[model samples]
Target: MKYGSTSAPIQLARGQAMSSVKPWRPDEPAATIHAEGAWLQGAFISKIFYGIIIVLSWQCLSLLWRQTTRSNYKTKMSFLAIVFAIFSFSTLHSGYDMKAIQLGFVENRNFPGGPSAYATLSRSDTPGNIACILMQWLCDALLIWRFVMIYRGCVAPMWLLAATPITVYLGSIVIGILFTIKKLTSGSGVRRT
Candidate 1:
């Protein structure tokens, strides 16, 4: 099946069944239909994994909170902020995904090119995508901070050593911003502009 602006063949697995999926009209391209089906399936799997991560994260956050003390207030608070930011971003991402899923499957199931296509056209998932990107940037920044801390005294020229990662991180931010802009501007992936 073809999806978006791309036309490529896709086939169901040998034993796979389409009983759960309603048939698309004959006028719609098979590729677009199949792509939507695939996205729906992937969304289901993503939710399952997201649930597991949320559980583990909450447990870790609780443990951290319990272990925090007055002496380590600064460090602990910083960590807490980072963790909370991550949690918030991820929650936003997941919530948006669920919202889109509901709209696609329940509210707009009959939308042209299917729910997946509708998602692309409407750009309804942009917030989720932004959250995901922000979460990634936060994680990367944390890693870089940890790296600098670890190599602080040992490195003869700390600034030089840190320069590469900082540059790369900045580059990534610019790229991400450009990508978001592109996504926001593009009309729809289902139809070529």
Candidate 2:
């Protein structure tokens, strides 16, 4: 089966049952119909399921913040912001994926003088993937922070150790964001950086 830019192949998940069905043809509908209706249905259902989980997690964190009085306000606020930022970025990324499918696969592919249905990968279509990348960078930094706190116990040289990784990580983040914006605006879906 094929979706948006029927030229590309749809990579089914592992354990997916393969049908002898041919890929979408130019003469056929822009949106390819697949035999795996159940899987397609489940995909949408999972999106909703995860969305609910995010809301629940947000509520629990908010409640915890309100109930805890022993924690330093700055520390608590900093952690809370990181958590919020990760979730917000992930949600934004999902939204971008949805929009890519709608515009590239469903609508544009069906119309003449329009974009390919599957012309671009969702992540590279625009700067939207930066949300996901930033989330990843933040999570990695948090892990590094935790390690530094445990092993070094906030010793003076600990700052030196943390500084190197932190600096490198931030530099990479800047490069990633710039690369995404450049490729997106240049109308290229692939990134060399």
Top TM-score hit: 1
Show where candidate 2 strays beyond 4 Å. Answer: 1-63, 111-127, 154-164, 188-193
Q: Which residue pairs does candidate 2 place in steric collision? A: 4-117, 4-118, 5-117, 5-118, 104-117
Cα deviation of 155, candidate 1, in Å: 3.5
Q: What is the lDDT of residue 165 in candidate 2?
A: 78
Expressed as tens digits, the lDDT of each residue in 80-102 for candidate 2 is 78888877877877776566545
RMSD of each: 9.5, 10.3
lDDT of 2: 0.63
Model 1 RMSD in Å is: 9.5
Residue 9's lDDT in candidate 1: 22
Quote each prediction's TM-score: 0.74, 0.56
Residue pairs in collision within model 1 = 1-10, 1-31, 2-31, 2-32
Model 2 worst lDDT window (10 residues)? 6-15
lDDT of each: 0.80, 0.63
Top-scoring candidate (lDDT):
1
Tell me how far the alpha carbon of residue 159 in candidate 2 is from the true structure, in angstroms, after superposition: 5.4
